[model samples]
Target: MTAAIELHHVTKRFGRRTAVEDLTLTVPIGEVFGLLGHNGAGKSTAIGMMLGQVWPTAGQVRIHGWDVATQRTRALARVGAIFETPAFYEYLSGLRNLEIFSSYTAPVSQRRLAEVLDWVGLTGREHSAVRTYSHGMRARLALAQALLPHPDLLILDEPGEGLDPEGVHELRQMLQRLHRELGLTLLISSHQLGEMEQLCTRIAVLRQGRKVFEGPWDRVQWAEGPIRLEARPFERAVAGLQAVGLVLEAGRDAEGGWVRPAPGITPDQLARWIVEAGFDLLELRRPRQTLEQFYLSLMRPDPQSDSRSDSREVTRRPAAT
Candidate 1:
């Protein structure tokens, strides 16, 4: 079956600098795929190429089996994107703005327009002038406009930017509902790792325009469990843990020390050792690894480690193109 989106060894260059290098990726249908990287990591360039706004220097990008380079309209007909800050006439009502934008694409019925507004929770505010709308409301309006085409794929670039916690929550819920109800394929690029962790099924991490890691969310490799150990008489607990060679190094969290057990040494064993040493084993459990930890490790790998040599500094671009 044709992938929902595919990039075959794609590369994009601007002047002497390459924005994206030898990128090859595929987003399966019905998947929430995340494109992640620090600023100037070529995320915007890749998205531009995928949307056929920027021509690639080498390789091909396809959407629903249509080549974006040569078949932009046909390919893009099935795709809706918010490539940057969504723009609408500030003087116009939300409904009027959508009506104007929809006219440029395909004619959408008024009923369908109402449905889209309702889907984005903008039903009552449809008649409100965009100048009066909050950032969250504008985002919802942008989403409503994207849905006007009834697209099979939605590409959102930092859709949650500037949203309050509640607004972000609402947007997440709305996207999840759309994915469930319409089987929509989402290609999202964002700095919000926490939100991406909550939304995406698969991810690709980029650095210096190169893809360093790509895989399902559950497949990220972790070296040590973030096992937390809380015990009475903290100094003794720390000493006992180090003496047994279980605590490799102190972790950043304040509440408990992390354990790096020797071979065949398990959490149960460590707890036993702590208890046998006469310290109260208050708590012992491996907390779930967060995406931030994984992302940091991938972006800034230790020089002493041989695991990943491709990791680089995570910094924003001086100026984005």
Candidate 2:
């Protein structure tokens, strides 16, 4: 189980400010690993270092076994990336845009451009001028450029930048398909967290230039439940149920506000209690966590606490220029 990507105490500083600090992580092969964070959480800085677009002030980034900074060409051979603005020559046709990128590919690169176009859902629109293509189309074209060299690792930064809902969905499907079928390891980040949940297998949360959380989707440790869970028919033995350590949700629900244990409680215990209570156990799941809710919970601040620590991060917005 060699990691496809590894960062060792990586730090990137700009003048007196550190964009990324003491960062370390591994992205295993064949997994859709997501880099989650706020606008100034150093995601782009880290990513730029990973791609050789920006040099780290300290530490190192490695892809497969190649050191990104020292062995730039070898390390990059396995990576495809889509950074912020997906640049393109609008005057050229979609196919031509791809063709231009394709010229940079080695002749032996696996039908590279064509394969990526189909993978990104631009098969029929390949001949359309870049100007005629929709925003989504342009993004996909940019993706095709990244895919041009048929790299084993794909790094997409805010991949859904200009895509409509439908376009975003298409990219999601494409990533899943590539990960499952082609054995491509995909690492992506986006402000569109809701969409990321549908596609990423594991996610790393970064805040204020440090790693806060990293794990499978289900294993993300949030201090509070994102959605309210309700179980109908409270058991008469409420005291006994509480003894098992499931907290009562403390709010009014049509059924009951008793919160279920996040990962440790068994449904059987509640189910049996419902039977004993002489009522049917109907719904047992919470509402799905929205991107907004999950992100806000992690970035949530202590109102009275000094804001000086992350004042820079909280106020920074994505580049609109």
Candidate 3:
């Protein structure tokens, strides 16, 4: 099947500075794919390229088999997006704003408009002026507008921005239902790691415009590194592990120590070794890896490189309305 989205060696440069560097990615149909990166990590640029708002300096970007460069109108017809802060005509009523928006696209019925507004929890607020709406209300309005066309693919960049806890929870629940009932393909980019853990099934992390990790959430949670153990006779267990040539780092917490086992060492082997040494194993598991931890590890600058350079952030283009 053709991918819902594809970027092959996509590179974007602004004059002397490179914003996105030879990045490639794929998102399949009916999947919630996440794009994670630090500020100025080229996430916004990459997303802009996908949305056909910014032209790539090199390579190609495609949406559902349509090349965005050559078939932007066709590709975008099937896409709905809220990039960065959603902009709307503040003077107009929410209903009127949506009417103007839909006028530029395919004509939508009143019934359809009502359905979408209700879907986004903006039912009665449709007649109210946009300027009177709170941040959360405006966000819901933007979402309602995006769903007006019943897009097959929805792209949201920092959807949780400016949302309060309740607003965030509501947004999550709404999107979850939409994705489930409509089988919509969603591409979300955000800094909210915990929210991403709940929303995305698969994710890709980018650092300095290059992909550092890409896989299912479970694989990312169990990424390779160290296994932590809280076993009895801690001193003896540590000594035994060291005797076997496995490097162990003392755990920051009181539970146990973390072991970076030898190349051929498996968890099972370590368990046997612990048993043989007469240490009662209380807990033996890989250190739980959150999305935030995984992202930080990738973004960590090399000790050999100048640390000052890591603090410099690239400016991204304004988000498309």
Candidate 4:
């Protein structure tokens, strides 16, 4: 089956500065893919290229197997997007704004307008002037307009911006419903890592206009967090483990010591070794790495490189069970 979105060797340069470089990605149908980066990481630029609003300086972008640059019409026919801050005539009612925007593409029936408004939780507010709407409400209005097309693919740029905790939760639930019931392919870009952790099945991380990581979250090769060991006769336990060649680090509050086992040694092996050595094993805990930790590791500077450059692309493998 054709992918919902594809970018092969895509690059975008603005004069002397590159906004995106050598980006190659694929979003399969029905996947909730995420684009993640700090400001000026070229996320919006890449979204623009996909929307045919910005031409790529090199390579190609395709939507459902249709080239965006050459086959713009067909490529975007079934796509919807809320790129940047969604704009509308503030003086006009929300329903009027939707009607006008929808008219630019195709005629939308009143029933379809009502359906989308309700989907975004803006049903009653549709008749209110957009200027009277709060930021969160305005965002919902933008989403309602995007849904006017009943797009099979939805590309959202910071859809969570301006939303409070409740609003953000609602947005997440609505997007999930669209993908679940309508089978819409979603490409979301946001700074909300925790929210992304819950929403995206796969993600691509961009830095300095370059894609440094792209894969399922489970595939990210996270730095091994230290294992906390609590044992009786701490000094003997430390000496016994160290004598056996297990690398030990100082532990935090209440922990007897921390163990970073060698490549071949497992945590279970360490526990067994302690018991066999006649030391009482009180507790053994390994803290799992979160998505935030993984992202921070990627963004962390490489000690070997100059200050201007990012660390090397993350090496990925199936995470240990």
Candidate 5:
């Protein structure tokens, strides 16, 4: 099948600075492909160019094999967007905002409006003016609007930004349903790595205007296993991993060590191993590998140490003194 989205050597610049540089990516049809990156990493800029809002300074952007520059409307015809903070006439009811948005594409029917609201769990609240809706409710309305056209490709920018824990959970389930049932090609990005971990099938990491990593989400090198770890003296315990040759990129905490345990290695075993190696175990906790940890590990510099050389140097230092 043809890719849902493709970028070939795509570059974008604003005056003196390049927001996206030499980026090349291809997302397959019906795949929930994630563009992972910190702010200013060109994720939004790349998506904007695809939306025909900003033209790329260099290279090409295509949606469903239709170049955004040449086939602007045709390419966009298959697309739907939900901005970071969507604009709606607050005075209008939830259903009214979605109804107005629907007019941008096809002629709307009352049945279609009701169906979209129900799909997004806003069927009953469809009559409530948008101003009274919570962040999550607003998101549902935005989503309901996006779905009205039955878009072939959906690009959602931080769609879950303001949701509470339960709301976020609900959104995740809804997106999964959209992908599984609707067969919609999705390009969704969010700052919440944990949610992305559960939602996206593939991921791409962008850093400082460049694409650093891209591929299946499962293929990203996490530097450790699946579980998150919290241990007392997390830093020191992480340091101890060196003695045994087990590697982990642990985040430091005053209360303990936070680790994504090595696959096949339990948190307790890691803690016991740390203690056996001559360090007092304050704590060792295992948490899941979030999109945050996966992205962060890609950004961190590797730890390189030569124990033999260090010992020799230390021995020489004492002799010289």
Candidate 6:
């Protein structure tokens, strides 16, 4: 099956500044893919190129096999996007704004407009002027406008921006329904790492205009995390573990310390080693690394070198013995 979106060696430069560099990405149909990075990380530039709003300096972008640069209309025919903050003519009714926007592509039927309004939970407010709507309500209207095209793929740039916890929750639930019920492919770019952690099936992280990591969410979990160990005779247990080649970092409390076990060492092995060494093994467990931690780790400077390394190649660091 053709991918929902594809970019091959896409590069964008503005004067002397490079916005995106050699970005090659593919978002398969029915997948919720995330584009993550800090501010000025080239996410917006890449998205703009995909939408044909920003021309790339090099390479090509395609949407479901249609070249965005050469066949923009067809490439975007099945794509809907809420890029940056959605704007509307505040003097017009919500329904009126959607009608005008929909006409730009192809006039949508009244029934279709009603269906989209209902889908975004703006059924009753459709007749109200956009200026009267709150931030959340306006967001719903923007979403309704996107859905007006009956798009197969949805691209959202910071959908949760300016939304409160409840509003964000509603947006998440709505996006889930769109993917589940309509089978729409989604490309979301956001700074809400927690939200992305919940929504994205696969993710690509961009650092300074280049992709540093791209893979399934579970792939990030394979990185080695600290193991919490609690054993009686704390001093002896610590010394014995170190003697056995386990690297230990002092814990917050005195009860236990954190261990970064060397490659080929398991928690079970650590427990066995402790027990056999005459320490009473009280606790042993590896804490799961959250997406935020993984992301921060990627952003941290590598202690061994000043150069940047591909995250995929070194996501899992070997434990020092």
| Candidate 6 root-mean-square deviation in Å | 4.3
lDDT of 1 by residue, 85-161 (tens): 78899999999999998877788899999988988888898888999998888998999998899899999988888
Instruction: Single out the weakest 10-residue window by summed lDDT for candidate 6.
Output: 312-321
Q: Which stretches of candidate 2 lie over 4 Å from their true place?
A: 89-105, 108-112, 121-134, 221-235, 243-255, 259-263, 272-283, 286-288, 303-321
Off by over 4 Å in 6: 222-286, 303-314, 317-321
Worst 10 residues of 2 by lDDT: 312-321
Which candidate number would show the highest TM-score if scored against the true structure?
Answer: 6
lDDT of each: 0.81, 0.71, 0.81, 0.82, 0.76, 0.84
Q: After superposition, how far is residue 237 of candidate 5 from its true place, in Å?
A: 28
Residue 67 of model 2, lDDT score: 95
**Worst-scoring 10-residue span by lDDT in model 5:** 312-321
Could you give candidate 4's per-residue lDDT for residues 181-234 as a string of tens digits?
998999999999888888887788888888877776554534354677888887
Q: CA lDDT of 109 in candidate 5?
A: 93
Looking at model 1, residue 36 earns an lDDT score of 94
Q: Give the TM-score of candidate 1.
A: 0.76
lDDT of 5 by residue, 153-244 (tens): 89998888878899889988988998999899899888888888888888887777787777776544233343344445556667677455
How many clashes does the backbone of model 3 have? 0
Candidate 2 C-alpha lDDT tens digits along 164-187: 788878888878877888899988
Q: Per-candidate RMSD vs. true structure?
A: 6.6, 6.1, 6.7, 4.6, 9.9, 4.3
* Order of the predicted models by lDDT, top scorer first: 6, 4, 3, 1, 5, 2
Each prediction's TM-score against the native?
0.76, 0.77, 0.80, 0.78, 0.73, 0.81
Q: How close is candidate 5 to the true structure, as a TM-score?
A: 0.73
- lDDT score, residue 148, model 1? 94
Clashes of 2: 3
lDDT of 6 at 306: 39
Best by lDDT: 6
Error of 5 at 29 (Å): 0.8
3 or 6, greater by lDDT: 6
Ranking by TM-score: 6, 3, 4, 2, 1, 5
